[model samples]
Target: MGIFDWKHWVVILIVVVLVFGTKKLKGLGSDIGESIKGFRKAMNDEEKPAEATTPPAATPLNQPTTIDAQAQKVEEPARKD
Candidate 1:
């Protein structure tokens, strides 16, 4: 025999109704429908590909890297007159 018969289906439905209640079941259905709609839209939108990111070229070994001297200085607060 098949796994699902009319009796089994009815019993499952009754159990679900008892657990979730009618109002919650209605809200669940609406939420599921919205999720499905959003999934479909995202799938369709994926037809257009986004731009690829490229890495920067490496600097020459001979050229020395420049350091900001100002960055090393820690300024002390001035005394009030």
Candidate 2:
């Protein structure tokens, strides 16, 4: 659904102004502004590295890449039996 109309917005704003005085409201606005700035900086930093870097190819270590070592060992003993 759409947002509430102007009447609801005015009532909410008046309640906020009454609950938090003019000075506190100003401080809250600054705090919210700083948080948004920090979030933007972090998002920009993440985008830069994704374009600049290529990850190394993954390699299977200490075993054949296609066959699981534990499965092979189990089957080997069954074949002998």
Candidate 3:
């Protein structure tokens, strides 16, 4: 028989159940189920086309655009002698 025969799988299942207990196993099962459901939902959401959104208002051609930004000083690392 192959290594993954029915008897070997049954024994492995028994050992796993005995090691983890029923309550923890049940909670783990539900957590796995919820995560799988969430994954499927995210996949479905990704597959669907996004809704149309209004485009930003266009600026007047006569007005020049101004950009505001802050500059930060970066310290140089000390040279190792």
Candidate 4:
């Protein structure tokens, strides 16, 4: 028989269920199902184009501003021992 025969898989499945118990395995299966559903939803959403929306007008008092800055790394001079 091949390594991945149905009988071998069944034994492995039985051992896994015995080790982890059915309740935890059930919860794990549901969690996996939910994550997979969420992943598919995200993929479908990504495939759809986003609607263009205009930003609200900003008043001087409530307008947000950004500060631009640049950083440079300084190298220390090596001293001769």
Candidate 5:
């Protein structure tokens, strides 16, 4: 019998369905499709940063004028109850 015979296809399909149920096969197919879709999206996203965009401007760092900003620990006196 030829490999492309209808009986061969039917037997192979039946075996596959019995081994991995239809629900599982469907979920696996969708998962694989989603992964491939995400991969394509990520590849396309990288090209967006290649445009001639200016680097981010820096903001001035805050420097405290008073030594109080560099506070040292001071002990509190004990209060009588």
Candidate 6:
């Protein structure tokens, strides 16, 4: 029989469901669907040119900025033989 036969697929499906319970199977199905959706989204994204993407909002030049740093001096304990 050909691999695409309905009987073979039914048997395979039965075996899979038996090995993995219905709840687990449902989660697996959803996970697989999400993965496929993500893959398709990524593929579609690749078709768009980078230049077409929106640029980040510009920060105002007059905004105040902070540059802070702290320096702590520590002395090591004297070694004892």
The per-candidate count of clashes, in order, stands at: 0, 0, 0, 0, 0, 0
Report the C-alpha lDDT of model 4 over 17-58, residue by residue, as the tens digit.
999999999999999999999999999878876554455886
State the lDDT of candidate 2 residue by residue for 1-81, as single tens digits: 348888889999999999998999999999999999999999998889665777788776876756545534434444553
Pairs of residues at least 3 apart in sequence or in different chains that clash in candidate 1: none
lDDT of all predictions: 0.89, 0.85, 0.93, 0.92, 0.87, 0.94
Please list the residue runs of candidate 1 whose C-alpha ends up more than 4 Å from where it truly belongs after superposition. 49-81
Model 3 reaches what TM-score against the true structure? 0.63
Off by over 4 Å in 3: 52-81
Candidate 6 has an lDDT of: 0.94
Please give each candidate's TM-score: 0.56, 0.52, 0.63, 0.62, 0.52, 0.56
Model 1 score (lDDT): 0.89
Q: Give the RMSD in angstroms, all C-alphas superposed, for model 6.
A: 4.2
Q: Write the per-residue lDDT of candidate 3 for residues 1-81, one digit (tens) a residue.
A: 998999999999999999999999999999999999999999987887665545589889999988999999999999999
Better candidate by TM-score, 4 or 5: 4
- Specify the poorest-scoring 10-residue window by lDDT in model 1: 47-56
In the order shown, the candidates' Cα RMSDs to the true structure are 8.8, 10.0, 4.6, 6.4, 8.5, 4.2
lDDT tens digits, residues 3-46, model 5?
77999899999999999999999999999999999999998887
Off by over 4 Å in 4: 52-81
Stretch of 10 with least lDDT, candidate 2: 72-81
Top candidate, metric TM-score = 3
Question: What's the residue-level lDDT of 50 in candidate 5?
Answer: 57
Residue 7 C-alpha lDDT in model 1: 90
